[model samples]
Target chain A: MSVTSLASQLQGLAPADGSYADLFSSVLPAVIDAIGEIASSLSTAHRVALAGTANTFGDDQLNVDVAAELVLRNTLAAKCPSVVTASSEEDPVEKPVHSEAAAVATRPEHCYTVAFDPLDGSSIIAPNWTVGTILGIWEGPTAVGQPAEKQIAAVLGVYGPRTTAVVAIRLPGSSKADAASSICLEIGLGQGQQASQNSEVLRSSVRLAAPPFKTRYFAPANLRAAAQDGRYMALVSNYIQQGYTLRYSGGLVPDVVHALVKGHGVYVSPVTAQSKAKLRQLFELFPIALIVECAGGLAIDPADGSRILDRVLQGTDERAGLVCGTAEDVEAVKKALLA
Target chain B: MSVTSLASQLQGLAPADGSYADLFSSVLPAVIDAIGEIASSLSTAHRVALAGTANTFGDDQLNVDVAAELVLRNTLAAKCPSVVTASSEEDPVEKPVHSEAAAVATRPEHCYTVAFDPLDGSSIIAPNWTVGTILGIWEGPTAVGQPAEKQIAAVLGVYGPRTTAVVAIRLPGSSKADAASSICLEIGLGQGQQASQNSEVLRSSVRLAAPPFKTRYFAPANLRAAAQDGRYMALVSNYIQQGYTLRYSGGLVPDVVHALVKGHGVYVSPVTAQSKAKLRQLFELFPIALIVECAGGLAIDPADGSRILDRVLQGTDERAGLVCGTAEDVEAVKKALLA
Candidate 1:
């Protein structure tokens, strides 16, 4: 059977107004290519070793993480002139990009700001568990202070036994009539080939199954929070009593993406006085929330039970708890956590 | 950096006495190839669909399971003459193999019996999560009525974003002075290449960390059992209270392998009145127990806390609960459950 590639699928999602045409055509594919390179390099023993440095968040960095950040940054700067600024989990502040490639007359409206976690789940990488790279492309020079809905597209590069990516695109200000325009695509990257060539679109226009799902699953991130908060503990207990299958892999990208692929799972990360939530807004939460929402799921702030997309991004390093997945499961999380 | 392939590692582990030379050289490589073929076939959409047939255990079999069993059965039949009998999870009864290829004079000592779960965790395959193949190689024509320790070798093929296999070899009657003879190797299969050619030895000799692990992790299978057994609930509660990380991925192969790769995790599958444990003793438990034991870890019967390897295989369909991983964590599970 024939399969469509990621580039072709992205081409189909590109808007008539050309709002994110450059991102769809250039920036995202480069990011995917960079991820493929990282996947190949990960098999080397030295790359998986500790880099002896910490990220901005004080998490110990692996050699793969440092190499991944560099590869992504360099790929974006060299290939995507439309990417005016970029920030990574390793270096949280926004940095200028493509200074030599983009002319002074380059249109700010056409340019995009990229925020990414170059190598997420680094702690679990040594074990060779599935980890990922998360990216959100915003329509302007920076993602700071912008509502998550203002983002044009998001891509999650999953590095597991295979290198695959989840690419979701939603044009800003699209109406309900244009709902079909929002798309989520799961694509497989060929091991040693360019992202545009051998990449296969595994799933197109991905959406969760309508709820009252036949089987329910729960991924409780930061389970430590349950110790300090009785409500969180109660929520987990309820999941167990209801026979919800536990699918947490202790990695944000895999856990969230698993829910999407299964078409029925709830992933809850709650904040508590003793255990603070550590998911960064720009690098992780916003991108993941967009992909979930575009795929007919819900992503919400666990504390206030508001749509995560509606919360404006205050800074690059802003952290928050998220309740995301099948709409019904997310709603259940809100009710249980807020009670 | 130069990397050692799985073939070379197996060659190194092959004993000069030639007890399991055929298994290490022929049968095991054939099994890995079958897994590689299954991995390649899994990407097709049709293979992931339901097969409308149930295994002997009454679980719904996916098309992949049916196809995987055929692929493995055929590969073994065609390539490995040393395999005298084989049985699979789908068809639990042991069946004779290679009647034409193997003469009546074929030595029983050299001939091996194989019991396998062609596709363990088939229930979770639809979501494109990692699943695996489990196999135990007995020294004689039949694994039935033989103790698990009598098995000379075990292989686990993991199909995830990448295809990999954990092959463990422990010659029957090996002494403690020859402990190094029992080796567990984690190998990566090349996506589109032969098992022996492109496969890399990801980890040469796999082992668990010593007790008092700085970071602890737990994978609690059959969480629903907590409702019927207060001790199970208390065990889970203690894990949370001790701040042990949860790393369950809902697939038996991935959960157990995660503990092996992490070097510190306890996987508990408990039996209660309401939730009868479903892991088959021969196909799933014996193979996994061998690998864990070979890797310097412990695999025990959750009910009585005896070494799982000491159990005799009465039938292919016998099922039991298991608590396996780092010795310390397994000790903790026995203490909490047996209290």
Candidate 2:
């Protein structure tokens, strides 16, 4: 289909089932455009060329601290309505809370919340797996003036690949104790009508050209490693031994985005009840379940197989752990919770 | 990057490693485009307007079959040096197979081969699941005047979603069986790279949406069911108590794709070696070991864990009954077979 046809099709989405899709269609292009525009201006990755060169290009945590902040700033500045930004970074900066991006708090807090990571996979900045931007589409900003604790109801992290968006959302009405979310996919194919199934189980054997792990497979060790520190070595050291590399961008949005695109997986922060600081960001677009599922993957909280959407219904925001290719892969970690 | 930049970047991939990468990259876009185009033309589709109405589609196996063939034809046509062609649908034909086309021949002694299932999931075409294409990239096309048997050599299967590309090559300059293809990605992704360690284990609880059977993970169960035909449904029913939906597409590529995308652990196609005619379509991309491992999946020839690739190298392409996916998932079936 031609780009013109795709634009029209995207416009058509507005009429499909009311204005939600329309509103989404209208804003997505601009939001993505803004993301791309200012990303380079950020001081975070001046030396970096691509996200995958983390091992060779730069440092992971510094990458996120600089890049995520820059992305959040640019995204907030581009739009007029978005207010009270949150992040997977340090904590929810309800204005004074975060010294950076203070203009966001000054703006009106209504209609739209976007959670994202400007640069993903900062850990391997030297030889990045893939650095990306993740943004979640949200309805409205969280409690702007209210104490940091009394913020909005649902939110998630969104990631961007080259120029794609992936949202991991907090199902409507999640509580502080269960900052849960659900993931669905919305691939902008520009094509109408479609179909297919999800490959829930993907047993692939791969050895890297640069070999990180010997890549062996067994149950216990694999589970334990990820649970211990997903960013330690390779978050998973199952089939491919040599202890596959582990990665965390320090910013959750970018990490999740990388998972969504590259077919990795997502992770909840794995902290205790998320602090108001934890309610840092909320996603605005990108389906929560579909994207992960489409790539033959899974996304959910690791603490309990609790329906992630339901968890979002409960109260909580700062949750963390890896979501994998299958419910089994995710649940395996949940079931093995030593904590 | 702008569209021009993105396109340029993709365009440059052809020169990165070898002409092969370039050739593959050039054809991939066209291949994906063909799949999309054929999908749009499906007789059973709802034209995107009435898609909400589920049952308004057709059930023509021919259309499904043609779609797969079209992909291979068009894709191969995009690549020039490919001197000859062979397909499970038809015998070897000239270069540049047309879209929605195939050639069937009765010739016998051909040694070179390329087998494929153009469309694998017509059975569950409506619900938007279990429909896909499998392309086998083989070496040595059927000889100018040889039979089908003489032309079947290297195998490659390009499956959709859950499906994968299993490619077995004679490797560069070496013809010996052991000198066979090195471990390349079974599923297609340049080569293996380190995966996060967090994604190491599987959940303990096994929850399937279909019938329970030990050895059968997912695939051409029609052959297996027929093997146990008299008691096939009954046997399958007994296993159903486990809670899996026969969610299989009841088609070749579709079923396998569904199983893989859903991370169903193992996908089984247990047609006895004797049922050659029934199992003539499956294809491969890279060696199964590499493919499966790359996709975070596994592939086990029904017989044993010893390298199936090794076995296929020595054996004729006539061998059948392939089981593939996660190591553990396939192991369960392997143990089930012993039992």
List, for all models, the DockQ compared with the true complex. Answer: 0.34, 0.02
lDDT of 2 at A106: 51
Q: Pick the candidate with the highest TM-score.
A: 1
- How far in Å is the alpha carbon of B32 misplaced in model 1? 4.0
Instruction: Give a tens-digit lDDT track for model 1, residues B1-339.
Output: 226655556776777776677877788778878878877776443323322211122267666788888988788777888888899899999998767536465644578888889888755554445678898888888988886767888888877645678888886467321136588877767656366556767677777777666677899998988877889988888888888888887778888887777677899999988888799999999889889888888888888988888878899899999999888788888988988
Q: Looking at candidate 1, what is the lDDT of residue A242?
A: 79
Please estimate how well model 1 matches the true structure, expressed as its whole-model Cα lDDT.
0.77
Off by over 4 Å in 1: A1-6, A28-58, A101-109, A175-181, A188-192, A200-202, B1-5, B33-37, B40-59, B102-109, B175-181, B188-192, B198-204
lDDT of 2 by residue, B145-254 (tens): 33222222232332221112332222333333221222222222111111111111111111222334322333324333333332322333333333332322344443
* Clash totals, every prediction: 4, 182
Cα lDDT of model 2 by residue, A109-187, tens digit: 3355444444443532221112345444445454332222222222122221112233222233333212123223332
What digit string (tens of lDDT, one per residue) describes model 1 on residues A137-230? 8888889888776787888887764566788888656621113758787776776636556676666666788856666789998997787888
**lDDT for every model?**
0.77, 0.35
